[model samples]
Target: MIRAFANPHRFMALSRWLAPACLGVGALLMVWSVWQGLWVVPHDDYQGGDIMRAMFVHVPSAWLAMASYMGLAATGLIWFVWRHELADMAAKSIAPLGAAYTAMCLATGSIWGKPTWGTWWLWDDARMMSVLVMFFLFLGYMALRAAMETRQKAARAGAILAMVGAVNVPLIKFSVDIWSSIHQDASVLRLDGPAMPPVYLTPLLIGGLAHMIFFAGLTMMLMRAEVWGRRGDVLIARKLSGA
Candidate 1:
């Protein structure tokens, strides 16, 4: 299936149909989830009812932030090994998306922390620092790509950085388990069960799926734009050389 879709034209055609559908469904799901999470679901017993609700957005964003970077790193590896233009473009396109999610994670985390942890921020936590490192990795990839003159060189360098930075992803996931941090341990991904109630869990799952779809749509759009821009540049260069 992957090999079948390796052709750019086929991929683009599929994207054209899939992107809009994903976006529409994602938007609807997100709105529904937010409504359910905020109004329909019962409040937490311990934390102020409304405050715990932020998990609907915060947790998913944090998960995606890490997931997106891992995707970028994987694409970067493909680009470096196969010298695939599409893979390189994908890596470039995903950087900002990863960064945006990372930022959302941190902001929502801080908001959640202020009431829960009694502080807006903390340095002692490994998870927090790991997230910060992921953010910097996104920034570093974008900056390095932008600064380089040639696309190939930029992609190569960025790929190296991405792969190196991927080490922090595992650290972020395992941080709570590894250290005696204030951050709560795994709830959603636990072996036994999720701690959240059914009402809250329903919306959380809905919102998370919505966010993933939204990210896919956005990444496809950005990749298409980058591919088009690069093709245009090539055309312009050819024209100038011919003239």
Candidate 2:
């Protein structure tokens, strides 16, 4: 099945239909979740009233920041082992989106921290450092890919870097527990289950799904663009060579 759809034409056909559907669903869910979170959900007991509402966007963006890197790393693995151009293109295309999400995570986290933690920044926290590392990894991957002259060489190098940098993903997830940090401990994925009430949780889950769908849609669109552009370059080169 993977081999069958590895062809650029087949992938483009699938993405055309799938991308629009995901975009529509994602937009609807985002609207509904934002509305519910801002109005229907009760304010937090400790933090300033209504300020905790940022969680709807912040948490989901953070989830996407990490998830996008994982997706990129997996695509890198496929590209490295299978020598699939489509997979390589997809990984390259997702780097910017992943970096954007990571930046959003840091920005929103700082905003949330200001009111809740009484400070906008902290250096000693392992989780914070891990997030920063994630951001740097994304930047490094993009820079290294762009630095190489040939596409093949760049892809190979980028894939190796992406796979290596993925080690930080696990570190980011467990950093709060692994070391003392100012950041709050895990709440959503704890063994004991969610700490928040259902009212807040309902909107959070909805927002998270919305972000995932959005990421998928965006990634597909970028992948399609990369595929088309690369094919065009190949054809141009072939024609010029024949001439």
Candidate 3:
């Protein structure tokens, strides 16, 4: 499947309808999850009353932030090893979208924290600090690529940074467990299964699925744009050279 999609034509053809279908379905799921979270689900006094509703947005963003980075890293590694230009395109496309989700995670986290932790930022919290590091890693990946002189150079630089920065993803995931932090630990994903009750858990899971599907649609859309842009560049170069 991976090798099949390595051919840009196949990917473009497949994504044409798949992307829109994913977008439509994901949008519907997102709307339903949001409605359930905000209006249908009963508030949990143990967590933070209605404020727990933010989990629908924050948790999914956080999940996507980490997942997107891993996707970037995996594609980067593929390009680094196999010299696949499509993989490089994928890595490039994932970066900005990953950064956007990371930013959303950080902003929403701060909002949730201010009310619960009584502070907008926590300098010492391991999970918070690790996630912050991951955010910077995303920014640095983009900045490093932009600084390179050529597309090849940019992809090479970005791939190396992504592979190295992947160390942070695990750190972010385990930070809460490894260190003492105010943040709750593994409410949804746990060895013993989710600690959250059904009412809150169901919608939260749906929200996470919605975001994941939505992210996939967005990534495919961005990759499609990159493909078209690259084609345009090729045409411009050919015309300039009278090829």
Candidate 4:
């Protein structure tokens, strides 16, 4: 199945329609989740009025931040093992988007923390610091990829780096547990199920799913654009060589 879509032509054909469909569904979900989270939901009595609502965006973006990098690592593995161009393209496309999400997570978490943790930032917190490191890794991957003179060289370098950096993913996930961090413990993915009430958890769930769909759509579109851009470069090179 992976090999089937390894063909760029097949990937492009499917993504052309799937991308838009995912985008539409993602937009609708975003609207619904935002409404459910911001207006419809009641404020947490413990967490300072409505300010706690930032969790709707903060938590979801953080999840996507980590999840997106994991996707990058997975594709990187495929490319390294199989030398699949589409997988390499997908990993390349994920770098910026993952970086953006990680940055947003840090920013929003800072905003949410100001009210809840009484500070804009917390260097002592394990979860917070680990995520910052993850964002930096994303930046490093992008830089390394761009610095390479050839796509083949970039792919090999990127794949190795992505796989090595993936060690941080599990560290980020378990940081709160490993250390006495100020960040809240895992509530959503607990073995006992979500600790929050259904009312609060519902919008969070919607937000997470919405972000996932949006990420998928956006990544596919970016991959398609990258493919087209590279093809144009090749054509120009050929024309110049002929001339």
True-vs-predicted CA distance for residue 119, candidate 4, Å:
0.7
TM-score of 4: 0.90
For candidate 4, write residues 125-198 as lDDT tens digits.
Answer: 66677788889999999999999999999999999999988976676658654664454542221213336888
lDDT of 2 by residue, 141-241 (tens): 99999999999999999999988888656766586446544445432212124367788888999999999998899888888888778789999999999
lDDT by residue for model 1 over 190-227, one digit each (tens)?
21244666777789998999999989888888877876
Which TM-score value belongs to model 2? 0.88
User: What's the lDDT of the predicted structure labeled candidate 4?
Assistant: 0.86
Per-candidate TM equals 0.88, 0.88, 0.89, 0.90
lDDT of residue 124 for candidate 4: 66
| Cα error of candidate 4 at position 236, Å | 1.3
Question: Whole-model lDDT for model 3 versus the true structure?
Answer: 0.84
RMSD of each: 3.6, 3.5, 3.7, 3.6
- Cα lDDT for residue 183, model 1? 45
lDDT of each: 0.81, 0.83, 0.84, 0.86
**Any runs in candidate 2 off by more than 4 Å, and if so which?**
168-194, 238-243
Q: In candidate 4, which residue ranges exceed 4 Å CA deviation?
A: 168-194
Which model, 1 or 2, shows the larger lDDT? 2
> What TM-score does candidate 1 get on C-alpha atoms?
0.88
Best by lDDT: 4
Q: Model 3: residues >4 Å from true position, as ranges?
A: 168-194
